[model samples]
Target: MRPMRLLGLKTFRHGVHPPESKDETSGLPIRQFPFAPLLIVPLVQHMGAPSIPVVEEGQEVQRGQRIARPDGFMSVSMHAPASGLVRRVALAPSISGRMVPAVYLEPFPGSTQEIEDGTPCPLEATPEEIIAAIQDAGVVGLGGAAFPTHVKLKIPEGKFVDTLIINGVECEPFLTTDHRVMLEESRDIFTGIRYLLKVTGAENVIIAVEANKADAAEHLRETFPSDLNGSVEVLQVKYPQGAEKMLFSALLGREVPSRGLPLDIHALCCNVATTAQVGQLLPRGRGIQERVITVTGPAVKRKGNYRIPIGTPLRFLLEHVGVADDVNRVFLGGPMMGAAAPSLEISITKGTSGVTAFTDTAAERTHSPVYPCIRCGYCVDACPIFLDPALLGKLAATEQFSTMTDEHHLMDCFECGSCSFVCPSHIPLVQRFRAAKAAVRKSKAGAA
Candidate 1:
């Protein structure tokens, strides 16, 4: 097949251009973070029912041992990140602002991080076997979504996938986990893609990297095996271009419906880090207990990607990295779409991609007053989904969220925060939309 390009630069419509604050750690190689004394592995780390605890409190467990069984098919299991004694099986604070069931493990001083249990599977396994191995490995979308990777490998009866798109577009500022992974784990990525191809029966795969990381793109293209049916596509740099929908547009010019998914267009997109993890774990029959994460921002003393255990607490991690005394805000993901960490007590989960702390000096510009919208169209121009955030913000202010969704395409907004970033008014448009969405979801749940 001939190489496909979306014309010059190749990008989707309407997005913000935040300063790429990645200079600090973009070039730094990944380093391993020492295990904290205790880990808090949340049962509901993925987007499914929380896992049911299989081990009782005070029970000793080995690193990578299964302590919680998946609740159902939609859920994924949880594993111990280190050899330790189960301190408790109780609620813990999550970045989601809710207390979720989590297993607290106090690591043994002499504990080795060696994973001792796994049934190695052959590469030529059947689709069912491959998917089962993936699920047993506990691999999820390491891109921050934390969706179980096994679920994506299963092809529905009628639906056929054509392309497995590996998203290497770390478009968010100050986050270079995917970029570093693409450079360091290219072989694993290819291995994982081949496995995905075998499972889904997809014709080919494409690794999409933004032009900002041209080196990674070049490296992947140069390193991609000649035998495999895959290629590397460099996309135009844009915020949220890393989003699955926007990525589809930039790479294949396919538009997923407002409420639809990439699967609707016969495409599967997984993060580069997630792909590497799958490639590394499935063959060994090992579970996901540790992952590489970017710890950066102005307030962080050591801003680099570190491979950390799944349940390491943010407080301990931040302290090790040496956060500034004046740090006022911390986010679990990227600033644009990441959830604000409610407290430092929250532990890192599968979904965590980065931990960004901002000092008062750095936060001054971001904490500006909420000025009223001046009828400027910057928000509309910046909206990638073409929704009127200005009007949505207005409707949200007056508690007219129902009408906003019914008529103004409120549900279509993915809360990329582009509108808010571009707005001169400093209106918290994204926050308003989030509140409105929460309210709508709550109302629907109540009605149901």
Candidate 2:
């Protein structure tokens, strides 16, 4: 075997190495969380226009029944996770801290967890037909982006796609959803990839996984028959290696132009879990109702990977997982890019990949007094996209958001939090950039 070398690993430049913090749940098998009293399926789960509710309050719905329809091409439909009665259509708290229109369901007593909904499409379905099936199944990028899968897969006019990149690199700490999925649901993942290859007509497929999960890579290598024009590439365990641009560069050595997508480089990337869902759901003609998630952190009593139903409340998850009374913070994703949950009443949407709770001790922030930058270039050294975070943070502090974007290349930063991680002064650089970006967007919207 080749010697293990961190420097020899395939990775991009300038990223931080935070604590892995995954041992607690990495080895645990995925368990199914019991149904909550009520499910709150939100319309605004996807990135585009929210779905429109097709059912009325007090109406009955079956498992895999459509409750809402897409409002536009960019939007996606919504489905019921269980056979139940519609409790009401009302505004509910979302992780974004905003109230969104949602369909509430009171599941029928003794309803089995089986999904018996959807019409099967033939294996030889045409590309257009497959795209329709995907849209009908309500598939989205499950890697936390939640962009409509069909929108990303549909090759636009005058454009061509050559390669499909499947991301199995669950590099985020304390999250093992994708790792477990890659191991337990390997066949489904490949089935999804085959559909993806057919959808985009890509010449080849590449599945990128981190070195930490070499077993998953090896399993795929051994079990996956060699005719799919696909290969498993092991990436160096690095923070933000799962970022689309960084992973693209690390694997292909090609720089995606700033503000450009993978499709611009004749490559399209999809989360492995998302692809697996397409493969699993489309053939059965069923829609997505739940997904695998990691419910792990220091404060969680029963830490493990879970196949959780979509629309399960955060309170339900915390109560089911048995969080400590002294839990200081709960986040919706991983520590690096995940957002803090504002309320326990907020339901888990399709985009939610992990539910993490940190106790007071684990969630403590640096108490050292904030100091001015010492002209240290640590932030610069840690930035993967080569943006000067110190400069951008200063510009943001002064409310010069326009200057930060136009001259300093502020938007290029994917907010992977590397600069903040390495900053000796403990400056909240990522927070500032996010605020600056939001401000710029708001300003542009107001002008428009």
- The per-candidate count of clashes, in order, stands at 0, 1
lDDT of 1 at 201: 86
What TM-score would every model get versus the actual structure? 0.97, 0.97
CA shift at 84, candidate 2, in angstroms? 0.8
lDDT of 1 by residue, 118-171 (tens): 887667999899888888777788888888888877878888889889999988
What is the per-residue lDDT of model 2 for residues 15-112, given as tens digits with 9 covering 90 to 100? 87889888788788889888889999999999999999999999988888888998888998889988899999999999888999999999998877
Model 1 regions lying over 4 Å from their true place: 1-7
> Per-model C-alpha lDDT, please?
0.88, 0.88
**Candidate 1 clashing pairs, residues 3+ apart or interchain:** none
Which residue pairs show collisions in model 2? 118-285
